[model samples]
Target: MSYFFQIVVSGMVVGSIYALAALGLVLVYKSSRVANFAHGQIIAAGAFITFYLTTTVGIPIFFSFLASMVITFFLAMSVERIFLRRLIGEPIISVIMVTIGLASIIDGLIYLTPFGTENFSFPPFLPQDPLSLGGVSISWTQLVGMIITFIMIGGFSWFFKKSTVGISMRAVSDDQFGSMSVGISVPRVFGLAWATAGLSAAAAGCIIGNITGLNFDTLHAFGIVVFPVVILGGLDSILGAVVAGIIMGLIQQFASGYLDGNWGLNGTGDVMPYVILLIILLFKPHGLFGIHEIERV
Candidate 1:
C-alpha cells in the first residue's frame, strides 16, 4: 500500500510537468491549428540558456530561470512572426514541415554548444533528505516542481477564463474569420499564444532541468511525449491536457513499477504511451476531451 501511494505521488509530480508542457502545444494548436515540431528545440534551448546563465554568466538560478523564459518568449514570437506568419493560411502540411525544418536548424545550433553533450544538475539548493509520510517518500525538488506546475496551470486557467487577452485568444481559436470581423487581430492572438506557450515551455524545462539535470536530450524529449498527452486530453482543451497528462503519468509509473523485472519487459513505460496512442487513434480518434469531428466512410 505504501509503495502504491509512493508511485501515485511521484506519478502526479511527473504528470503535472507533462501537463504544463502539453499546455504549450495546446495553446499553439488551439489558436493557429499548426502543430509545432520545433517545440522540443525551444524547450532544449530554454534549458541550455539557463545553464549558460547560471554556470557561465554566474547569475543565480532563480533569476536565470526568469531570464530564460523572457528570452524564449521573444524567440518563439520571432519564429512565428518571421517564419510562420508568412506561411499563414497556407497548407497545414507546409506549416508543419516548416516547423520540422526549424527544429532541425535549432538542433544543429545546439550541437555547436558544449552543453549539448554534457550532464549538469542544479546546485543543491533544496534539502537532501526526503520527506516521508508513512512508508512513502517525496523529495524537495519534486515537491517544488509539482507546486510550481500547479500554480502555473492555475494561473493559465484563470487567464483563459477571465483576462481580456485570454478572451481574445479564445475568440481567435473559435473562429478566425469571426474573430477578425469582431475587431480582434487573429495574427496577434496567434503570436500571443506562441509567446505564452514559450513561457510555459521554459518553466517546464527549468523544472525538468532541476529535477533530472541539464540534459538536452531528456528535456527535449518532452516535446514528443507531449503529443500523446494532448491527444489523450483533447487537442484544444486545456482541461483535457491536465487530465490526460496525469493519466499518462500514472500509466507510465504503473508499467514501470509492475511490468518491469517480472518479465523481459524492460522500459515498458517509455514505449507504452505511443502504443496506447495508436490504440486511441484507432477507436476514439478524437480523444476524451477533443471535439469530435470524425467523418465516417
Candidate 2:
C-alpha cells in the first residue's frame, strides 16, 4: 500500500509536468490549428538558454527562468512572423512541413552547442533531502516544480477566461471569419497564440530541466510525448489537457511500478501512453473533451 501511494505521489509530480508541457501544444492548436512540430525544439531552446544564463552568465536560477520565458516568447513570435506568416492560408500540410523543417534547423543549431552532447543539472538551491510521509517521499525539486506548474496552469486558465487578449484569441479560435468581422486581427491572434505557447513551453522546459537535468534529447522528447497528452485530453481543450495529462502520468507511473518486471515487459511505463493513445483513437477519437465536428459536402 505504501508503495502504491509512493507511485501515486510520483505520478502527480510527473503529471503536473505533462500538463504544463501539453498546455502549450493545446494553445497552439486551439487558436491557429497549427500542429507545432518545432515545439519540442522551442522547449529545448528555452531549457538551454536558462542553463546558459544560470551557469555561464552567473544569473540566479529563478531570474534565468523568467529571462528564458521572455526570450522564447519573442523567439516564437519571430518564428511565426518570419516563417509561418507567409505560409498562412496555404495548405495545412505546408504549415506542418515548415514546422518540421524548423525543428530540424533548431536541432542543427543546438548540435553546434555543448548542450547537444553533454548532460547538465541545475544548481541545487533547495534542501538536498526528500520530504517523506508514511513511506512516500518526494524531492524538494519535484515539490517546487509541482507548485509552480499548478500556479502557471491557474494563471493561464484565468487569462483565457478573463483577459481581453485571451478573449480575442479564443474568439479567433471559435470563428476566425467572425472574429475578423468583429475587427479582430486574425493573424495577430495567431502570433499571440504562438507567443503564449512559447512562454508556456519555456516554463515547462525549465521545470523539466531542474527535475531531470539537461540532456538535449530528453528535453526535446517532451515534444513528442505531448502529442499523446493533447490527443488524450482533446486536441483543443485546455481542461481536457490537464485531466488527460494527470491520467497519462498516473498510468505511466503505475505501469512502471507494477508491470515492468512482472512479465516480459521491461519498459511498460515508457510505452503505455502510446498504447493508450492508439486505443483512444480507435474508440474515442474526439477525446474526452473534444467536440465532434460534422462537415457535409
Candidate 3:
C-alpha cells in the first residue's frame, strides 16, 4: 500500500509537469488552430536560455527563469510574425509544414551550441532534502515544481476567465470572423496566443530542466508527449488539458510501477499514453471535453 501511495505521489508530480507542458500546445491550438510542431524546440530553447543565464552570465535562478520566459515570449511572437503571418490564410498543410521546418531550423541552431550535445543541470536553489510521508517521498525540486505549476495554471485560468486580453483571445478562438466583426484584431490575437504559449512553454521547460536536468533530446521530447495529453484532454479545452495531463501521468507511472517487469511488458509507461490515444480516437473522437461538430450541407 505504501508503494502504491508512493507511485501516486510521483505520478501527480509528473502529471503536473505534463499539464504545464501541454497547456502551451492547447493554447496555440485553441486560438489560432495551429499545431505547433516547433513547441518542443521552443521548450528546449527556453531551458537552454535559462541555463545560460544562470551559469554563464551568473544571474540568479529566479531572475534567469523570468528572462527565459521573456526571451521565448518574443521569440515565439517573431516566429508568428515573420514566418507564420504571411502563411495565415494558406492551407493547414502549409502551416504544418512551416512549423516542421521551423523545428528543424531551431534544431540546427541548437546543434551549433554546446547544449545540443552536452547535458547540464540547473544550479541548486532548493533545499537538498526530500519530504517524506508514510513511505512516500518527494524531492524538494519536485514539490516546488508542482507548486509553481499550479500557480501558473491558476493564473492562466484567471486570465482566460477574467482579463480583457484573455477574453479577447478566447473570443478569437470561438469565432475569428465574429471577433473581427466585433473590432478585435484577429492577427494580434493570434500573436498574443503564440506569445502566451511561449511563455508557458518557458515555465514548463525551466521546471523540467530543474527536475530532470538539461538535455536537448529529453527536454524537447515533451513536445511530442504533449500531443497525447492535449488529445486526451480535448484539443481546445484548457480544463481538459489539465485533467488529461494528470490522467496520462498517472497512467504512465502506474504502468511503469506495475506492468514494466511483469510478463513481457517493458517500457509500458512510455507506450501506454499513445495506446490510450488510439482508443480515444477510435471511440471518443472528440475527446473528453471536445465538442463534436456537425457540418450540414
Q: TM-score per candidate, in order?
A: 0.97, 0.98, 0.98
For residue 116, what is the lDDT in candidate 2? 91
Candidate 1, residue 289: lDDT = 93
Worst 10 residues of 3 by lDDT: 286-295
- Residue 63: error of model 3 in Å? 0.5
TM-score of 3: 0.98
Cand. 3 Cα-lDDT:
0.94
Which residue runs does candidate 2 get wrong by more than 4 Å?
A: none
Candidate 1 scores a C-alpha RMSD against the true structure in Å of: 1.5
- lDDT tens per residue, model 1, 1-297: 988998899889889888989989999998889898888888888888887898889999889999999999998998899899999899988998999999888888888887778888877778989988899998999999999999999999999999999999999988889999999998899999999999888888988888888888898888898899999888999999999999999888888888988868889889878988999999998889999775699
- Please give the lDDT score for candidate 2: 0.94
